[model samples]
Target chain A: MTTEPPPDAHAAFSAVALTAIDDVYRFARSLTRDEVDAEDVVQETYLRAFRSWHTFETGTDVRRWLFTIARNVFLRSREKGKREVTLDDDGAEIVDAALAREAWSRGGLDTILERADLGPAISTALAELPEPYRAVVVLVDLEDQSYESTAEVLEVPIGTVRSRLFRGRKLLQEKLMQHAIDSGLIPQPTAPVRSTE
Target chain B: MNHGHGSDDRTGAAAMDCAGAMDRLFDFLDGELGPETEVRIRQHLEKCGHCFDEAGFERRFLAAVQAARAAEVCPATLRARVRDALRHAGWTEAAGS
Candidate 1:
């Protein structure tokens, strides 16, 4: 059964939702990490968005509303069981800091960032990250969304967004660090020579 | 994490130490910290070389991540597919146009 939307409601959806297609598609691609699946997710997302057009509150962010719908669509399309990752925010931050310190000591990550082209490496690495972390990184960093907006989109706490973002960036950095070493952009780690007394 | 020397005033001259600065580095980079804490961290960074370098690396790394997917947009075929799906579900360009 189809319920026709009022003309004004349809116009509003067109103005806001249609304009956000690119952003929504980019977000879906990040979630799916596969072009075909991303297309499917986007198609379904728009369909749902149009049907629920009246439910979207005016003067609020259209992209955020659309993103929430898109995320739900992606989740539904995934396996039957939704994977829940329990994050010990404090512990995770501690580990992330430790790993970052180690990476810095091994061979300056700043040097790698300056010397190497991270575009290809980053895309591959982002694709490889776990969905929980990848989604946060994509929304917050790639899409330039705020923490509050991303939290709402992912249906997680702001703290969760912070932790996931930190973890995601660290994981991606680890991958890029390896790529830099493999590509000879940075020298292999070497032990310091002891001073002879 | 050794947060830093216990100082009640975050924006004062007696700002946090390297440990404190490093602890809040990610939040600082992400603009998630409060203004007072931000000032304190900024002051600490000005005086602390190690923390400053770490923050710089993190900042650049984030910028790189943002750059990686910057060029990607919705493909034309996907756009058409979505539009078609919307039309099939009773959306009309006339209403929107």
Candidate 2:
């Protein structure tokens, strides 16, 4: 399940290197959001961690190190494929366009929100989030890791995690608010929540 | 739809309307509430469409968070690439640079 320091021999750690699979895959899923991609990330992380298992030198936080590798894989993927992805923030606009198309589409972005079509908007805003902040958010909000665990995964100070999360939420709020207004889902302040869709 | 506050609660009257409620509403929907407080918030949401819709926004926001920039798992051929890289472990580098 987990790797233990060696006699180079411990049954528990030796049996299967899958102790952290669930955590690994879940965070990986949050990172890549595709089950198959996540499976690969986990597979890659495990193999790497296993190989480096000896050099682990007795005191390192393997999970964070493994996550660093996983994060790298993510970064590499983004860099390699950035040209292909949409990466735009007009997600709310897209939602509006989709809803408008459906003559039977009664609910607006709010309904979209219910259905999570707002994934695009959230994704757009997430793209706007800088690297470690974005990573921290993925670990915290989506994967629900504890604060210390996130700091470990990002290999940052605990304080950095707090600041990034705070700033990240502010940025998201501003972005989402702007989107809500522009799409006519939430009315201008005068009408606010009651505006007709 | 109705934006006006009802006459029952003291805080309801002193504060802003549905718009103002929407501002605090995201926190409510994010499930940040304490147990007792969450109950009250949910009760409010259960009755109000506007606040309920705001909750919907939080759900969609979560979905976006989940899907955002997430890896698109490559097809089986791509999987084989990863598998090949994985075979090498410590020296593993994805194929094709």
Model 1 reaches an interface RMSD of: 4.6
| Pairs with backbone N, CA or C atoms under 3 Å apart (clashes), candidate 1 | none
Q: lDDT, candidate 2, residue A142?
A: 60
lDDT minimum window of 10 residues, candidate 1 chain A: A188-197
Q: Which 10-residue window in model 2 chain A sums to the lowest lDDT? A: A188-197
- lDDT tens per residue, model 2, B2-94: 112222233432423465455445344444334444455666677788777656755665555555434422345544554455444323232
Query: Which one wins on DockQ?
Result: 1
Question: Across residues A1-197, which tens digit of lDDT does each residue of candidate 1 receive?
Answer: 35667766777778888888888887887788788888998899888888888788889888889999998888788652264334455436544654645654434556656534667777776776665777898888887788888988888887788778877777667666666666676775573212110
Highest lDDT scorer: 1
Clashes of each: 0, 4
The per-model lDDT (C-alpha) reads: 0.74, 0.51
Enumerate residue pairs that collide in model 2: A1-A19, A32-B70, A32-B71, A119-B64
Query: Once superposed on the true structure, which residue ranges of model 2 sit more than 4 Å away at CA?
Result: A1-47, A53-65, A71-112, A176-197, B1-78, B88-97
Writing each residue's lDDT as its tens digit, candidate 2 over A151-172 gives 7766667557665665455455
In model 1, state the lDDT of residue B47.
Answer: 86
